[model samples]
Structure formats: structure tokens, C-alpha cells
Target: MRARYGCVCFAVPKKLIQHLADRSGDEGHKQMLQAQITQSAAMRGTRASKTVAGVATNAGAKPLQRSVFDAAGQTFLPGKLLRDEDDPAGRDKDANEAYDNLGIALQFFSSVMGRNSVDNKGMRVDASVHYGFHFANAMWTGEQMVVGDGDGRAVKNLSGSLGILAHEFCHGVSQHLVPGGLGVVQVAGMPPALKGEAGALNESFSDVFASMIKQWHAGQDVKAADWLLGEDIFTPREGRAVRSLKEPGNTKLTWREDDQIRDYRQYKATDDAHRGSGIPNYAFYTAAAELEGKSWETLGQVWLKGFDQLRARSTFLDAAHATLNVAATLHGKGSGTHNAVKAGWKKVNVLA
Candidate 1:
């Protein structure tokens, strides 16, 4: 009856959440955060099953048609349909924001990328807001989106952050764009995971595209864009943003606890997907800066299409080569754009 992407991906990393849990002084709040992580991990199996059956699509639906549901502080997904595409804004703030955010994502993909929807088949966007009491994360469940209210202690107002919303939405886009969920792989007994370097590339794609979407929507060029991911997600006392593509692991640009590494040589297999994503994220930022134009105009579609060449276990070097080939194909053998793309990967030590 519905379509599901091939994997489960979240805008917020589990490692970051675990960090918050560890530092939290309130035992009840810490336990609640931990419980949420457990619940989230369990969702992997349920959503992965939906994808295994095949990606059922809405071939007849329009690009902008969507439904935003109100979860009413419960963990169940898409609790109750709050607003349809044609419906007026509702009384609930989070629900309306979720509805609008999804609309923005749909418009960007359709109008700029010339894509119908996440599945490129006009699939209706489904989203839910107010999921879980004081939940501090947002995630794409392969089937739809789930947004949290935030704990107010560290993260607050998740539904209101456009960057964060776009990041999660792009998780859906990456899942559909690259079959087998980019870097995600479904093991025999476990849910599909963003494992190894491929998983980090998967995360990097989301950050790159999410940054593009934000810049495009704001009428910003590469120079004008803030280049901060989830800048509004955390409390000021905790950090500035969740991550920074321009300067990954620069805690001054993000939070004090950020551990993202931009150099491929610095990447460890044990690093969280978000941490490892800094390599590609910085690469894209560098190239876009060198190209000196809007990221969407210069590299967005190429990056999106380039990911289609990815396999289940594709690594950083694999991504670097694939994206460079895509740029060369679209621009020219040694065109300025192609060279810029190469420079990006090379800057991060992903290319020779």
C-alpha cells in the first residue's frame, strides 16, 4: 500500500545522542534518551522489511501532494493525518512546519533537479511531527519522516529547522536515488545499516544536498550560504550547530563535542557516520567554493546522479572516482567543473 526507502537514516547521529545521554545529569532524561535510541534501532527491521517487498510507488500522484500527521507525543509513526496538501495550515505549530518543510523539499527536487519525488515517480511525501515526549531527534524511516519536539535542555524545536528537515528528507532521496540505499546493506538477520565507508558517503550525500537545498531556497550563492548543518538544533550552551560542512570538527562552528574529520587519512573505521562524513562534506564545500556559483547550479544534480553508481559497499575512494566521472560526463573531459570536482576529492585525500 505504500513505498519505503531501502534503509533507515536519521538527521541526528546516534553517537551524538549517546553523548548527550552520557553528559545529562538528570537520570530520568538520560534514561528517556537511551530508550529512544533503542526504539529507533528496532525500527530498522520493520522499515527494512517494507523495502524488501519492493518500492511501491505513486505513479499518478503530483509532486507536491503530501500528508503531515500528528503523532501527539507518541512514538508510533504517522499517528493521525493532520494536514493534506490542499488543507489549510493547522493549529499545531510543529505539524504545519513539518507540512511546509516537506513541501519545500518536494518543490526543490521537482523544480530544480527535474525529479518528480524521492522515488522520481511523484510519490506523495508523508511526515509526522511531535513524535515521542521530549524526543531530541529526527529521522527518515524509509517510509516517511518522524520529527521530535526536542528535550529543551539540549536540542529544541526540531520541526522548525529547515536545514535539519532537508537533511532528513535527503536521506529519503539518497535511498531512492541509489538503489540498495546508497551505503546501506541488509544483513541476513539484522536491519540494513549505514556500515563502513559507504555509510559515511551516504551521510555525506545528505549533508551536501541538504546544504544545496537550503542555499537554493534562500537565494544564496556558495559564498553567501552559511554552510552550517542543523545550526538551530542545539541549545547555545551546548553548541552552535550539529555539523559544519565548511569546517567539519570546528567546534566553534558547531558544538563543543563535534568529532567530524575532513581528511580521509584521519578517518577511522570506528568513527560514526556523521564524523566520517566530514571528508566528503568538506570536499563538496571546497569544490563549490572553487566553482564560485550556486551549489545546485554547479554540482547538485551531478552529485545526486553520481551516487547512482554506488554499490552496497562503496568506499570513499569509490565515491570520489564516481562523482568525478559524473562531473566529467556532464561538463566535459577537462572542463572547469570537472577539475573542480576532482580538486574537492583530492583536497580531502580521497583522490590522488
Candidate 2:
């Protein structure tokens, strides 16, 4: 029987208790137990019982929406996928495009490196499309990756290129790869924002991996790698390409104003321009380029290993150190891999 407050039914007769008390001299213990029962009853009498959100309802549960595609795996909220207006053939928005890109990204990770999934633990990948009306950007929101069909002028298709998807999915990979993992509570010694940098590294790694996939697929020399994410995704509305790997500020776009079309050229800066990624984006490209040959085969492995081994809230320096350690451990202290990683950071003034 359930206790009323702290009172439990004593099935034993009072004569049985008297016999036990005489044998054990436990009268004080019995009295204490009786007192506890009385106090518990007092507390319970003051308590209230009520139903909340129905007995079996989970109305407050945070649901995760998941979707799997050929290029990558993504989870996202409802009403995310949007149409791509920039397709010259007007076929980019086809759902199959998302499926195809997801396939490519997943295959690149598994087939290229012999890895299973982003976390290597097989966490479900999530993707969302048509985020926000005519949104101009795509992002991996830590939980799921979301893509936007650009304004038909700046960015045309969401799934036309594998690198773009890879970049976003890499965020998931990085979240799992970090030491403490994502959404961890802040410890006394660590800064919360530093933990967020793992997301950035995730994006950076995706770009690196995407470029590697392109090079591997094309069978191109590392030096000759195009490093461009979407070569054909941009429309004449934006005179320039989606983003340039070799040059940051030099991509030009053409916009129409008052029925008169004018070509505007821009370089990436701190301002809100896609071109601004040129600085750090190029740093990653430069690092990989400096370590030529099959990137996933060597340089990519180094970065992956480093990212996986470091803490969740790593800095650029932490990444540099991890890369250096991996290089020295795998190659040697002064090997070309070591020197190249060092030089790559030096070029960006990120390291000595």
C-alpha cells in the first residue's frame, strides 16, 4: 500500500512488536519511526495533486525533424525547403537535387575516409530546404542543416553543388568531433563562446572537405583545384559567382535597378557580403593547397584528426597545435606536412 505522507501500514500485531522490542531493546527506534510518520503525514496533507497537459501528452517535447538524402543527412524544422529561381533551366528546385547532394556528401565522408557518419556514431543527419522566403544564405544550425534557394540573383540552387552541402554538414561532424561535444554547459574555466567556435571550424572543415571531394572527383592536381563551391549557381542578376576560392573581393554581380541593369563588383569584407569569407575561407584553401596531392588522403586526415582530438571550444591556435602534433606524430617533427601546416597558418598570421 502507498504511504500516506511517511506513514506505512504496520501489518504486525502490537503483541509481535512488544516481543521484538523486549528482545532487541528498540523502543526508542520505534518511537522515532512514529514521529517521522506523523511529520510526513503533515507535509502530505499540505500537498496538492493536479493534472498537467493531460496525463500522457508530450506537448512540451522538442521534436527533431530528420531527413536523409544521397549527398548528406539533415534534420530541420517544418516549412524550410524553398524553390530555386536562378536555375536557367528552372529545374534546380527539384527535391531530387537535395537528395542527390546529400548522397554525394555522405559518400565523400564514408568512401573517401572509411568513416561511417558525421560523429562516427551514426547520429542521424538532418536537412531542410526553402528556409525563409528568398533567403540568401544557408547554414548548419547545430541541430540541422538548412539551405536556402538564393534570391535567384545571388545564389540560384540549394543543392547544385556538393561543397555547399558538405560545408553545412561538416558543422555537425565538428560538433561530434570536438572534445566536450555540442550544447555542453559552461565549466568554471571555459568561455561559452569559445565552445561556439567549434561550429565555425565545422563550417571550415566542410569547405576543406568539399574542395577535397571536388579534387578527388575531378582527378585534378591539388595545385590545379578550382576551389570554387558553386561555379554555375549564380544568375546574371548577380554578375559574380556564388563565392570565389582563389579571390575573395573580386567576385562581381550584376543587379537590375529601374529596368536598367548595372554590374557591381565587390570584394569580401567585414560587411554583410558573401565575398567576406574570402579571408578565412582562403586560409583553409591555402593550408590544404600547401599540402598538395590527394587532400582527403593526407591533409584532410590531419585536419580531421586534429579537430577530433581538440577541445570543443578550440581557438585557431588550438587547431594549429593539433595539426602540428598530428603532423609530427604521423610524419615527423620537421616533415613537409608539419612545415606546410605551419606555413599555412603563418600566411594568415594565425601562427608563428
What Cα-based lDDT does every candidate model obtain? 0.82, 0.49
Residue 125's lDDT in candidate 2: 48
- Alpha-carbon lDDT of model 1: 0.82
How much RMSD separates candidate 1 from the native structure?
A: 3.1
- Summarize candidate 2's per-residue lDDT along 1-352 as a digit string, tens digits: 1111211111111222232233333556445334433432342233122222212222222221125222222222423333222212333353456555655666667777766556564444455566544433455544545565543433465556666666666655655566444222344443222123343344455556766777777777767877666555555433433344555434342111101111112221122212223334555566667777766677777777877777745655677788879988998988888888777666665564
**Regions more than 4 Å wrong, model 2:** 1-93, 179-202, 237-239, 252-280
Highest-lDDT candidate: 1
Give per-residue CA lDDT, model 1, range 1-352, as digits (tens).
Answer: 3434333676777877888888889999899889878877776767532221122245436668777877899876667778877889989998888888788888999999998877777877777898888888888888788899998798887998888998888888777776567667677778767878988998988899888989998999999999998998888776788889999999888876789999989988977788899999999999999999899996887787778888868898888888889998899978988998899999999887
Q: How high is the lDDT of residue 228 in model 2?
A: 64
- The stretch of ten residues in a row with the least summed lDDT in candidate 2 is 1-10
- Cα displacement (angstroms), candidate 1, residue 273, comes to 1.6
